[model samples]
Target: MTSEVTIRSIQAADTYPLRHAVLWPQESIDYVKLNQDEQGHHYGAFCNGKLVSVISLFIDGNVARFRKFATRPDCQGQGIGSQLLRRVLEEAREKGAQRIWCDARAVNENFYRAFGLEPEGNRFYRGTIPYVRMAKSL
Candidate 1:
């Protein structure tokens, strides 16, 4: 998969498009909320220097909570999510995080489980859809 993919932190200028392309497609993503409370770390995956996926990690104490993880629809099946997740998890471990956790979209539990995460509790709703709380010890 030497497709010249690079993973790095999000740039401020990419706030809007990255949100639209990844976080919320039909409804507009609220960049203002982030501007007012920028409390997380965001990572962007690039293919040939063009962004193809985005993942955000919200750190709270010793845990890292991943959020808004999305890969370009066209690139979804090609392992971009897996790669980005691997890097993000590694980064968390390096940063002294004792645990890495996330609200995995209901349908994506198997994918997260493949990386050794275990469901910690019952599914919870985010807006309307449900998500599972998955966690792994770093």
Candidate 2:
């Protein structure tokens, strides 16, 4: 947190550790991995050269979806997540995505809203966690 955050494309496997650590500490690290990870574009936010946040973006036609976005718990309020998300959004647009979306944790809906993503559809559950679809036109 002492250094500036840098965002860069990373291999999908590079996102696994932080994804497991921040999003589901109780689950196995494999639980945080997506079957289609190799086909997606992954981005990491590094602070002082230490990876602190990760997000995976997938593009299909003109639609882009981002998943497994997790910021290190200790780095949560430092604006690192914001920087990473903004980069992902710009990446999507650069890649010809007309829209972008995510299955956002219901409790963190406000965070997505700040980036112009609006909640859509009803709330749903993944195990015991509540989630909602959020999207925005790029």
Best by lDDT: 2
The positional error of residue 112 in candidate 1, measured at the CA in angstroms, is 0.5
Residue-wise lDDT of candidate 1 within 1-138, one digit each (tens)?
668788899854454576576656766666323542377777888998889888777777788878777788877888887899999999888877899998788888999999999999899996777889999999
Whole-structure CA lDDT of model 2 = 0.96
Clash count for each candidate, listed in order shown: 0, 0
Overall lDDT per candidate, in order of appearance: 0.80, 0.96
Q: Give per-residue CA lDDT, model 2, range 56-138, as digits (tens).
A: 99999999999999999889998999999999999999999999999999999999999999999999999999999999999
Flag regions of model 1 displaced more than 4 Å.
Answer: 12-16, 31-37
Candidate 2: residue 1 lDDT (0-100):
52
TM-score of each: 0.85, 0.97
Candidate 2 regions off by >4 Å? none
RMSD of 1: 2.3
Q: What's model 2's lDDT at 63?
A: 99
